[model samples]
Target: MKTSSFYVAFDEAHKPRGKIAGNYSHLKEFLDSQGFICQPYMEFPITRQNLSPYDILVIPCPDFAKFSTNEIDAIAQWVKEDGGGLLALSHAGGDKGRRSNLSELVEKFGLSFENDQVLDYSKNFGLENLPEVVNFSPPHPITEGITSLCFRAGCSLSTVGLNVVPVAISNEESDPFSTPLIVTAEVQEGRVVAIGSYEMFRNEIPGGFEQPGHQEFCSNIFQWLKTEYREKVKTGEIKPKVTIQEPTQNYDANGITANVGSQPSFISAKLNLSSHIVISDKSDLANLFHGLLDEVTVLKDQIKTVIETIVSSEEQILETQKATESAEAATPLELPPNIEPLPVPEPERLTEMPEKPKSMKDTKKKTDTHLPKTKTHQPQPIPDPLPMTKEEIEVELETLKNKLNSIENLKDLVESKYKNKSYTKAQYEKQIERLSNDLNRSLNRIKELEMQYTKGKK
Candidate 1:
């Protein structure tokens, strides 16, 4: 296998800089173990002439506020034409003071870093109560094996005109509009992998924080970058093959027994029952058989544990569903209060009329006879309606209380569902037990089979 080479770039004027400062050291060590030669720019000045020698170029979180447009353009053009892989990391230092030139560099590949920190209480990493959990979307090769990763002081990322693929997402409880934890884009001829935070690869995060396949993730990037180089030297792929041989038949008191040997043997006897036999190299065949048996045993235990965990989870889900249904059923329907009908006035008896009023001309000669004719129909004031009955009010209040209680119950159910414990511990324990038992059983079985085969041969 040909080794891959990577050139890491860092800002010169910045302190606490260089590849070894942050996650770079972790990345370098991981790549080196996979037969990659990582060269840091700080060790040798980064010039256009020197850049052409590297297969991949990595830019760590740098204080790029002082870099001129020409410098950014130079780096961008180099990546676009040479088809070299680029990695851009962001941190608190690069986000503050002046506009980061790193932002301009990433913009060439159609990515941008937002000047805001992503704080997610739900996805936070570690015990410090900071948002650190990153949710991956699906099975992309780059992020296929990573479910969640720990990050410290992460920023946000956004994309522009390029077709960017997001690798990880912040929890919903975090800033919804902020950048994802990781993003990538394929530009003119090169690819760019952008990491929003540098703390993920830090020394304090612990090595085992990532999922089972994260080490492969670290290797894939470098391997992808050096794929062309590796292809030139690769010969042929190696694959394992298996061949089964027929065994000789021998009749014995224990029904019909087949004589299984590494090589075919000549033996004649009447068979009580015909059975297909297999033969192969004793050691190789035994090892393969033992491996399969071990795997099967392990699988059985794993399946059993998984079934139990699924059953428990299903029961919890059912309980939550029932609670939800009850809460919904208990919701009260409100009805408008009953209106009282107005009382009809009783018929009044006609009263005798006195003398008729004098004419307007006769009244006008007397005192102020211009008194306005009284309104023929005067409007009567309506009486205020009585308040609703105490019973009615109590019934309405009780309905409201019931409605509130139902709402509270629904809220409780939701919280409980989210707070429910996961099957992590139980699944892990089962897996460990199953694997251990299978290993032990396989060893014992192999020993017994070897002894039996040896005795039969003699």
Candidate 2:
């Protein structure tokens, strides 16, 4: 059994829309399965003293409450000086719509949430708000193995140069082109990640935690966030304590129940933490049965809370409303189906289609000269009789090399799709065969050009 080493705290104060016991229960369960200690911090006015016990702090979109400047400064100090990981999530329309100030807290680390929702009408899961993102630029750790992600009713993020960077971005067809969907920064000794969409890892939906790349994305972000500072925290290298009192609650390893006027809770799926006891006789068996009955009672309450949160989930509808408004505002210029806008008119106008030659005898009387000559296309370029110059050889060689580069790039793209399981074995092998043939031909042509160019130079 993997012992819990890394401590993770979910900020439940300031009235966050999601919590461990409710909308985010699945996320809590997943982390618990990984053997991480998950808890909720319900303490008010988040201070450095209140944050000392944990290695990572996740603030999942405070609804309408704003964090005090002092609290923000303390959180920043903890991350920079003491080496703690910070993950902040926000919805669409950002601070203004949510009536919160998460941007101010994250701005200290060169990241901020934008007042916008990402939408792609051409590509999505039934609606424009759920934009499917395939573009991962510059290849950072958070997006390492992610091929695609659904940014469900989320906003976009902005980052400053160098210190902060975007790992994932929206598709080309999205409203905001190539804007950052996920941003990360490494400040001093700690790490910070800000995501526009919190629902990207929410319990269950089309573009929820079950999305193909999202689980891997969560793993990557957490692994990167667990810095050397966290390692030291585990080793007891530094003994920083939370001086402020934390709300106490029983840790239910199986049930993972957390509620208001309650501490945040997560179930231990991997770590079977229930106290071990030997059932030597009838008395021990009776005691175990009593405990199991008690567990069933707690689970019922947890289920009730989960249902309530789901119904109340996104009460403001800030992200969805904002996304809808954006969609309505930007109505695409779509032409009627099956007809494309033509820049130039066809060769012959509609009236000039040869008149159908009234009859065969009339067509025979009409000379072939009336018909337009169909020009024959030649695939190969006509050769010059004169000997070629070295400059011309150099130009041809460069062009052939460029063709070879294009072929190689296509090969890499196909291989990546196969590795990600996006392509079937048969499709992969067939494409590889065709691309390999093209690849060999390009290589041979380039080789011939190089030889000709060299001989010409000589």
Candidate 3:
């Protein structure tokens, strides 16, 4: 098999529902056959320094979590400056369905995922979730030679900037006919592709890798996504926007530059505490300390969960990866006939997502609080509910608590930025209001979870 320098990283830090080797081994194998190196990105905080080595980053459906503001900025900046390729994938019903905020990150590239699944009853592959789509728009490299392909249980997408283009659409027979299903962008020196369905790349599943034209389409996507800019960075042609190399100070508890430095003594170090941030009084400083402590707690829980997931799944993950080595020998799992009744996706609970704020320093808006709410929840599909274990319930509760902590930390960080006048009053108000809504939603969701747990116990 031929190989190339194009490196692809599948993010594993944010609790993605699909593991590369476990669920996307087919994708890994395909990319490998094309000479691309694939690896799981498990680095925490997602700093530019950590991402500098790769040409492409793929986020495969983060579940029940939100990427921190710092991490999002890092990713966005990496793609725009370092010639990185970002391929953020989501499932049916989009971010709202998964209880995640991937659209938040991809919006930086002028594309957003919709909260509706594409369904075609008349034109499907044995089932409605497996929508047979053949719509290709004005010729684009990514859609080259791709006539028909399986959309496979995925949501839709919308584009904004002129640089961003939609290459594929839903058939007139499907729900929301002709809407964008795959959006791409030429952002600065980098490239971005956002697709709603990650399932199409799975191994031995209906509407998956075996879907006739899928392999050809996959080749086109990778060939287009493998940006030449990564090679530029290697030859010292450009510098990354993130400046972590010089004097290192990873994100402080506030996810911003702080007084903390790696230097041994304060005399030679660049002191940021007294210079940049205006701590009105001792009380404010105390509050900062308290916020740091809370942040520490959140980080601890995050690390614990990541470690536990790795330890628990280590063996299985390795076996799955090893299984890929002998893939040619293994007979593909026979896809079952579509006799099983179509599983109804949970009714989508829609949230009014505010239009993307034009600028980070955007002026005060006329209305901030009463804005529409948006959500994407992968319903407990129409299939029979599986029995839940006590451990599962406990883990869920912990996850909810951790999310609450993260929101609080984000609130504090934004407020601190406001205090320093880094954000306009309007920007601050808008962020705080959104964070407030997130807090309430997380609280309500916790109650709902507890009730379900109790009902199960009974």
Candidate 4:
């Protein structure tokens, strides 16, 4: 019956700079009011081992640094096996500068976040920046009692799995025609929710949570998460006891019949002998019936006593066998006559082994008269090899190729940034110069390794 606990991660390399900027204190306080344990989860790169302690994990508005392959796999596995809840919040331009690579994590649960932003001028709040979301669809457990919400610079969600539910959508003014704002889904034994905006739960934003139905929407999300973990607890609790019905018997003047319950025991076994019985004489029928009833009662008690005795004897025999085994193991084995024990030599005798006739030591001593004495092996410092083997050279060549590819990607990103006016011309030139130097050095190394590999092959 304890409250649910949440671990909010803020250790992302590109998380918003200041507390007021990306902090979720408003959400934390609200969760606290609902009797939840909220704690900051700074120690991460979220793995399965560390995730077991929390009922729910919240990564609110992460950065462009994508989670490692192992981390993504761990989070997915933890959610499925531990029945953990996950909440991923992404901002506009997902995977772009200062934004998150949340798609890697969300895709595991069959959810996706679009790179473009959703702008609704007509249905938005007072400012165009705050896109109003009045289209709450499906009305799931997480979106219960939620009709309207205002999102600040949020993106859109897409469903890739049958289990995925579109919780909300943008209006007609959205950049892309009426897209999904929030997506929720179930994966294995767990639940997941992905929202396009993190700012909806932030405090002190102009008409953020102050807007109508914002707080209710936030409450419903956490409430559903908490209820999920609680339901799992209830399902795994001790099962109810089964009831056994009494045996029923029907009697006629001509014959008697007995009906046994489903779980047939000793009584049923006895009844198997005769389903029907007949009596010929009416004069002694009453006496015979009384005698038969008494006999059955005695027989039942005898059978119960016999079963208990057999069970007790079996347990006693098992314990006795275990004790005998332990005793035998503790005792040492007797030595065989064929295997003679070696005699313990005197202390002085133990210092030196007896020499055999014409031993290798005598031969070596004679040979040493003509041979030069050997010098001590003074270990020389071995230099590190450069692509010593063909395999090594091939691996280095592949690594260089990957580095070159990365450099090209960086160049493309730089161009994109310049076009977006995020970098000045001078800044762009300096970055390009550094990247060019790295690319040139990598290309040269790749050529050298290739030449060495060819020579080795020849």
Candidate 5:
């Protein structure tokens, strides 16, 4: 197979600075390793004829301000007619010298470069408080595997049209209301991926080398370009299969070969059958099956862990409920006894006797009468009803049932779909096991809730 060729057209007048250059150099090495022939535009003339042979073209952060209108138009026409890929990166839009021609190029593809430099103190990257760290949209393949990226100094972009796909986003940290990054139009029937920050490809920024999605973005773009070229080849559309045939020999009853052609036909059939079996073995189907099984095994293990965690939590909740119930039951309730009242007829006589007697025994009796009697019985404080509300219990039960049902359905679906395809059996089993674990966790949760409800009723 012929290797795909790529041409990287960087404007020396507007080329990416410092780390950006270094990063591009690294990208070049990476693509070369993948069997692509990469050539920088700086080493060649930036003309339509010069770029015609390349499968992919990249205009990396070109200082369009230096390019004349005629120069920009030439590049646009080349892409339109030849269907070669184009990547354009720009700085803040107001820099007329650099942005003028580049902006024009992007516009031809239904995209516009915004003239604002985004300042986001909230999402700033470094300790210096510059908003270099930017978040991206999770949906696009270019942004896949990238959660956050740091760009030294980057601009924002805007676009319109179905061909554009927003690869990244600036959160509240950039501008409260601004679309920060975008990819515009399809390339040679494939899409052109554009990013707002030229700094994302620079090396000086911390994590520039290790940033999530950086490598993937570069790789995916080139791969996409290669796919476009491959689709162009008539014979490359599908791979051809090999066939083998066996020859046969036959003889006439007269001991001399009467029909030599008949003998060859008989031998050909047997040989063909043997060759077919040999060719089938070379398909590497076994290796493909093993790889799929391995993936499934890993998935199954993850599911098991999740289930265990859920079960442990459910048990803890059950134990807590039981302890609460025991504590409530152990609390004592006491009722005080009633006392009888003495007769009141001796009130006047008692006053007279107290005045006449000054003896120790009489003094003791008077002190006892003056003291207030203690009451024994007090009603126990009423216990409040169990804490679980009706709505809460019903919701818990419903959730548990739903989780179980989901798991069962998933397991059945996987098993039925993958039964005949055991080479990838692990993948299906892994999904099934994961679903089963989820169901088990739900069942455990349901049990815990039932226990709580029963205790509350008691």
Candidate 6:
């Protein structure tokens, strides 16, 4: 079980240089503790090749300069081809802080940032500017354990793509009835999360993550983004290079060279006239080449062995099939003979009955009394009627909702029973896994129905 670290790059070009703001030290510290290597993006004119090495690219409150057309194109292509993750953050009032244009980049993935800021006078933190968000969409991993979140001067966002989803939304009491502050979308093979307020991740900002559930939300975001890369690293899909500790010193060919000690100090040793053996040094070179050739020969032998093993396996498989066929042909199956109907026996005559004791006869007479027969009737079957389009959609939507509720209840029951010590750890885990799968299916069905309903309106 080997593990590897993922490289995370922050966009320094657009980072807020304000002494107090635009810094991601807190975010970096949290990610670092999770075994991620954080660094500033070095590519000036960002390209796909330059961004390939990093698993996630963080664009935090870009204020000074917006992503150029080329940079946007490269970033999109990089995410699509490299299967990387992206975290794009923007502040309140659209680009109020003179930030660079990010909509152009995110719009390519079907995400749009609203210009107006979302504020709730009643459900805010101290000041009306910082709105507390309590309304969250149903059971997403990102918002699984999260119940509430607070935003500072954050704008709203929306997406139209089927793969795009709103992670968190403002309550109906807010100015915008159902404003989505945070969103996530699947772009090709990559994942992108867009948060409206950069202040939420900042350290010293008022109404910052110090509020309840904010830190947990951030952790969820990190977990979702890095889950794939972490698995890849553990399975050795991505390898990190190992560096040597020896000092590397380069020497110049100044016509004169001196060895300070017996050990060679240069990363590569200089060839002095006295040390050089012109044509006679062929033996070492020949031996090195011969060793390489021997290695090649060994590889060829291994390949040949593998091919032979595969061929043998194929032959064995063919032989097994032939044997199975021969057995089936040799032992032909026969159908069972038809079963005969049993003969019905006739009843004995009453005149041949034997006499019984007075008490037994009296008891039998009392027990055997005559009864009247009743008639039987068959009911007609009812036919199913054709459902209206709207009625069908509603029925499906209700069914999905009911299934979702059932899953939730089952999940709660499992947790309660596990807590009560009714289930072992292994049993609890197995049940949880099955319930989670059911929950996911129910959510997907609900989303599909909602989409269909919206399209019907149009």
In order of appearance, the predictions have TM-scores of 0.45, 0.55, 0.53, 0.49, 0.45, 0.50
Instruction: Give the 10-residue window scoring lowest on summed lDDT in candidate 2.
Output: 263-272
lDDT of 6 by residue, 1-458 (tens): 35355767676544332111123456666777877766655356777766766778888766546677989988887666566788888766566433458877888786767665677878988766688887778567778888777788677775544467887888755654355789988765678889888778666556665667777887788777764643564467865322111112222221011223222212232222223322324533552344345335433543454465557777888999999999988966555678555679899777867777786655444533566656678777766533337666787677667657766886787788789996679767866775676567567767877887787788
Residue 338, candidate 4: alpha-carbon lDDT: 97
Q: For every model in order, what is the number of clashing pairs? A: 5, 0, 11, 1, 22, 1
Q: How close is candidate 5 to the true structure, as a TM-score?
A: 0.45
Question: What would the per-residue lDDT of candidate 4 be over residues 127-151, giving only the tens digit for each residue?
Answer: 6657877777776877777776887
lDDT of each: 0.50, 0.73, 0.72, 0.62, 0.51, 0.64
Which candidate number would show the highest TM-score if scored against the true structure? 2
Regions of model 3 farther than 4 Å from truth: 1-4, 235-458
Cα error of candidate 5 at position 402, Å = 37
Best-to-worst ranking by lDDT: 2, 3, 6, 4, 5, 1
Q: Which has the greatest lDDT?
A: 2
Candidate 5, residue 233: Cα displacement in angstroms equals 4.7
lDDT of 1 by residue, 1-458 (tens): 22223443333222212234233455556666776655434212234444554556666566323345666666676566555578777753235522356677787775667565565555554432246555777546677655556544556665433256777776645543223667877665567788766545543334221433446666665565553322332322321111111112332221122233211111221112214323334632553354345335433543454465567777888999999999999958665579655689999999998777765336445557788867688688877544444454445445434434543553444344345742245433543443344345434534544555555456
Q: Global CA lDDT of candidate 3, please?
A: 0.72
Pairs that clash in candidate 1: 123-133, 124-131, 124-132, 125-132, 157-179
lDDT, residue 299, model 5: 35
- Model 3: lDDT of residue 169: 81
lDDT of 2 by residue, 74-185 (tens): 9998898778899999987789767789999998896678787787888898888888988888888888878888998898876542367778877755755456888898
Deviation (Å) of 404 in candidate 2: 34
Residue pairs of candidate 6 with colliding backbone atoms:
63-99
Model 3 lDDT at residue 199: 76
